[model samples]
Structures are given as C-alpha cells and as structure tokens.
Target: MIIDFHSHIFPPPLIAARDKYLSDPCFRLLYSSHKARLAAADDLISEMDASGVNKAVIQNIGWASHDLCVRTNDYLLEAAARFPARLIPFIAVQPLAGTKALGEIERCAAAGARGVGELRPDVQGFGLGDDRVIKPFVETVAGNNLVLLLHADEPAGYAYPGKGAVTPGVLYPFIAANPDLKLALAHWGGGLPFYALMPEVGAALKNTWFDSAATPYLYRPEVYERAADLVGENRILFGSDWPLLGQRRCLDELKALNLSTQTLNAILGGNAAALLGLE
Candidate 1:
C-alpha cells in the first residue's frame, strides 16, 4: 500500500518541445541543465513497479509564466486520466493570475484533478505572505475540496537546482490563515518541524503534514526518524520526488532507518491514503 506523496510527469508533446520550456529564464535557472529528465506516465509507472510503490501523487508545478503553467497542467490532467489507478492528478496555478488562476483550478477540478501544487511561489513569482495575490488561489483550492501541496526549502541547506526560498517564515503565516486546509509541505517543510518545539507554533500546525521528497539530496535517512519524533508519524508522508530523485533509491534509504512497523506504514502510505481519501 505504498503511496508516493510527491512525483512529477509531463506529456509527451511537452517533452518533445523541451527547448521551448528550457528557454524560460526561470525554468533554465531551476533546471540548470538541458539534460534534465522529465518523466511521462509510462516512465513513472515502470519506476513505481520497479520500486514496489502501489500508487503515486503526481505534483504539477506552477511555472513562473502563466502560459507554461496552463500547458504543463493540460498535459498533467490527461496523464492522470490515462493512468488513474496508478497516478493521482494535481494542477499548478500561478497565484499572481488572480481570477484566472482560480479559473484554471476550476478547469482542472472539473476535469478530475485531485489536488493543486508542487507550488513554488519563489519561482512562480508570488509571495505566500502576499494575501492579496495568494488568497484567491488558497480559497479556490479549499472551495473545491482539493489538497494543497506547497514546495518548501530549508533556508540553511546547500543550494541546489529548484531550491526555493519558501522557508517556514514565509509559509507559516499562510498556514496560520488556513488552519483547516490539509496542507503538505514537501522537503520536510524545509525544517519547519524544528519550530514545533515552540508551544504556540506547534498548535498552529494541527492540519500540516511534511513529505520527504529528495531526502537523499539534502539529508540522511535519519531525517525520517527525527521528523517523525518531532511532528508525529502521521505528519510525515513518504515522497520520492521521482526523476529528480528515484523511488527505489528513496525507499532503500528509508529502509535503513529501522523505523517501527506502524510508523513506517504510516509514512510510506497510510497517511497519504488518508489525506487523499483513497481509503
């Protein structure tokens, strides 16, 4: 019952037009390499099979440019439909799009998108702290019963491709505003769990969850045990950030943690199933 909480895929057509997407300044900045890999649905399923992952949540990114966001999203929606059992769909939206962003969400939801994100406000050009810009996006997601998975980066960690400045300081205020939204922050909330030591901050995180996407890129397998200890096993979701990382590689690292069976099951799949309403 292993469910990967974070992964990405693009349509074959987009992959075919790699040069166009790669030309975007922001895309080039993050990808930093023309050789960067983008997986298609088939590639994802094969990796999932090889890694023993039963299901995966495909996270779409809100590119800095609105048109790219829409194009990437269109491909993601179709891919999810093509492999519904193995892949759950999520759409990307530029909060700066205002009403248009909300409209995009509506379009994807109607087409059967289960959630919204891999949202990178830093690269996407919207400050999570800017309520005027981001409120509509959050409201739209909540209104439609969709999960919110925002990208988070540890402020003190080494620089890497796609690392954003969405640290706890920038994201916590937004989380506080939407207490009811079941938000999952990728990359262990960029070390947000450490703030849970503060009595008041811990109380504000009642609805927050953290995913271990690309753990090997930044930390050791002990991160799983440490994060679970700080935030409880239920707050941790297993995520491979596949293609950027690898599902089998992430699982192998997790296996080294020697976590208790219950905790392991909760992080690997149970928590994601509950969050996603997979039952």
Candidate 2:
C-alpha cells in the first residue's frame, strides 16, 4: 500500500474561507505570499483515491496561538476518527502553551492522534536547541508512543512561503541530545543527509529520518537516490506535501530514479508503515 506520510487538511468551512485565513496577520506568515490549494478532509480523500495512495497522515501545523492549534487539531482528530482506515491524525502543539499544550496532546491522543507534528519552530517561535522549552512535550509524546515530525529549512535554500529557519545546525543539537525521540524531518531535513559523512552528525541521526515533502521545488529529482545513498533507504519516508504539490508528482519523480525494487518499496511505503505501525 502506498502511504503518503505527510499531508494537510482543514474543515470545509475553514477551507471555504481560505482567503481570510491566508490574510489573517498570524496565518499570513505561512500563506500570505503563496496561494496554494487548501483542501478539506473530503477533498483529501478524493485525491488519495485518484492517486492510489492507500493512506496518509494528516498533518496539522504548529500554531502559535492556542486557539488556532486547538481548532485545527480538533478537525484533524474528528477527520481521522471518521475515516480511520485512510487517515492517521497528527496534532501540532505550540510549546508556548506549556501545560495547555500538554493537555491538548493528551486529549488528541485519547482521540486517536497517531503523532505530533508539521511542527514549525521557526514559525511558532521556539528554540528546538533549548531542551527545557520542548522537553515536556517531547516526553509527553514519547510517553504516549506518538511520533514527532518537524518542518525543516536548509540554511541556504531559496526563500519561499512557509519556509522556516529551523536549519540543520539548530536541529543537530536537540536531536543529538534526545536520542530516543522519534523524528521525521520534512523537506529532507534541509539537505542534512549530505552531512551524514561526519561521524558525530551521523551518530546523532540514528533516531531521525527525512521525508521528501515539497522536494521537487527544493532540489533536483535525483536527490531521492542521492539522499538514500547518504542516509540509507530505510531512513527516508514518502511524504508528499499534498495540495502544495500533487502526490503523483513525488511518486512519478521517485519512480524515475531507477532504484532497486527493494529500495523503492521502502521509500514508497514500507519505511512509513514500520515507523507508523501500519499493517
């Protein structure tokens, strides 16, 4: 089964008011400059059906506002519950919310959230390098057996809408310190695999993996094979940051890479299946 590990959705009402949300001072940070297609869960289902994507993890962004986070996460939880077989819900909590965020995590987990993420520290305003700020949330997620996914930015990539400044440098310190945290860094960890040649960096990366969400816009399609060689095929997950880019875009790009069927299978679905405990 093809499991697209990264995607997003909003409630129909929210999607209908996309222009307003895109213009809101806070939400504008991610959507002001770019007007990409935003979909409701039902739209996502239709895309999945058309793309032949068997399942997808619905990623809610880390909203700095407590109210926004809860609103989006609530929809994700309900959508996942309504379509248990097709959607795996992942909630994003603002670390600034402190106890409230923890409570939100608890509530979502109880409601069947499989993970925590689409976390954008750059946008949400937190230092992942600071253990104190995120430790409680990390521990809560770990304690609950929920995977963590963080949005990533290359220190040198061209600027774009929703691009955050969580460079690999910032990611290294925290990821190294918390070896037990299960992490999947979106956008191929901002080209971090290339640094895996460094022993210490490679060691610190044992528990982390990279996802190819919005990859075509960031790098050449050959990056899929190149990254696999540097980080191992097992550490790559198939994540199409859908709506921004079609699921078929990533699928077609990867298929043209001429990789072995075993490696292809791993990138296409097996790796995410194992990480997410999907059958």
Candidate 3:
C-alpha cells in the first residue's frame, strides 16, 4: 500500500553522458557523479524494495534540455511497462514546444502514461501559467483526467546551490489561473501551504495538491503535520524525489511525524492512487 508519488529514474545512456551534455551549472552541481551512477531502473527498484515501497510514480527530470524531455518520457514509459506493478509512469511536456509538446503528451498517454510532469519553468525557460502555452496542454490533460505534477521552486529561506529562483509567488498565479487541471506540486508545493493559509489564495485554489518530496533536506517532520492542518489531508501525497533524495530517508522522516493513521495512509499512497486513478 506504500506508494512513492514522486520518484525519478533515467536511462543508462543519459547517465553515461550526463557530465558531457548537461550545461546548466545548477543542474550539474545537483547531479553529482554518485547520483548519475545510480540512475538505472534496476537500482531504483532495489532501493524501493529495501524501503518497503510497493509502487512509485516515476517522473522525468525536465530541467535538462527540452529535447531530453521526450526521450526521457519514452525511457520512463518503457521502464514502467517493464515493471507495471512496481512503477507508474508520468510524462513530461514542454509548453514551449507548442503542438509537438501536445503531440508528445497524447502519444505517451496512449502508451499508458498516468500523469505529466515535474515541469520546471525556470530551468525549462517558459511560463507554465501563460494561457497561450499551457491552455491546450491543460485542456488535453483535463480532458483525459491525467494528473499534472509540477516541480515547484520557492525561496528556501537559505540560498542553496543548484536551486532555481522561481518561487511560490510565481507558481501560485499559475495554479489560480488553471483551476481545472489536477495538479501536484513537489517539495510540498515549495512551502505553498504557508501561502495557501492566506484567505484570498486558499479559497481560490482547490484543485491544487502538494507532494512530500525532498522533505528531509528542506523541513522538519512537523512541517507535514502543519501542512495537513493548512491544506487538509486529502490534498497531500507522498513523494520521495528518489535518486536526488533517497526513498528510505524521506520515509524515515515521515515516520517520525505524529500523524493520524488516516493522514499517514493518505500521504503515503491513498492520495496518489486516487489522483492517478490507480484505485
């Protein structure tokens, strides 16, 4: 019943050439040689089994080049197909690519993609909230009821290496603008519960949800409890952000929290199953 709602896996060729092709200094710094060494599907499965995670929603790192998004989605689809019971694949779409991006999403969903993203606007160099770019993509996903997972970057209080400057301020507008899209934000929506606490914004955004990915590096365990208080338990989902942050550490941190059994179950897997229609 344990599901990691947010996890990453890359093809071996990408891992082999990660150093040579990755030009973004932030991305390069975040991806150590050690990280690249463990990007295989088999390695990820072993890690999941060790952590007692029954299933993981595998997301692609869209922070690289746009071209790589399509390739990575293909690789992720293949990986999920190889291990359907263990892995659920989420596709990545670059809005800047126009019809081609829309086409990619259609093709992948037909091939069994359950969701879309870990979409990074700062790294991907586009505005997700922009109606012109995101409208069709949103319509397509909404039409199909596919979940849209976004890599929400916020001001982390302290300046961290390899972190993007995009903040919750930027992401909130997008969420507000697109109310119909079923969205999940990574890094607990990059501290979005704080903003959602405000009356004006929270009332306006009900379709949004947060994922607990990379929580160990970012916040204390009580933050999850506080988030549940602010956003409600149904709005939260478990995400390990695997490879970047291991599954064991994230789950360990979650276990330390004094959450209700129902809340814990929802955050761990129930919400994800419901969001992706795995139920």
lDDT of 1 by residue, 149-217 (tens): 998988896888777788999888988888988799999999999899888889989999999998998
Question: Model 1, residue 143: what's the lDDT?
Answer: 89
Query: How far off is model 2, as Cα RMSD?
Result: 1.5
lDDT of 2 at 131: 69
Residue lDDT tens for model 2, 1-279: 799999998778877776667533346765555466678899899989998899999998777787888999999989988899999999978888899989988989899998999898877888886667788989999888899999888899578877777888888888887899889999999888999999999988998989999888999988888999888999999999998899987898888988999999999899999998887
TM-score to true structure, per model: 0.96, 0.96, 0.93
lDDT of 2: 0.87
In model 3, the runs with Cα more than 4 Å from the true position are 24-29, 32-38, 63-66
Clashing pairs in 3: none
* Residue 86 in model 3: lDDT: 95
Off by over 4 Å in 1: none
Q: Tell me how candidate 1 scores on lDDT.
A: 0.86
What lDDT is reached at residue 254 by model 3?
88
Estimate candidate 1's RMSD in Å.
1.3
Comparing 1 with 3 on TM-score, the higher-scoring candidate is 1
lDDT of each prediction vs. the true structure? 0.86, 0.87, 0.81
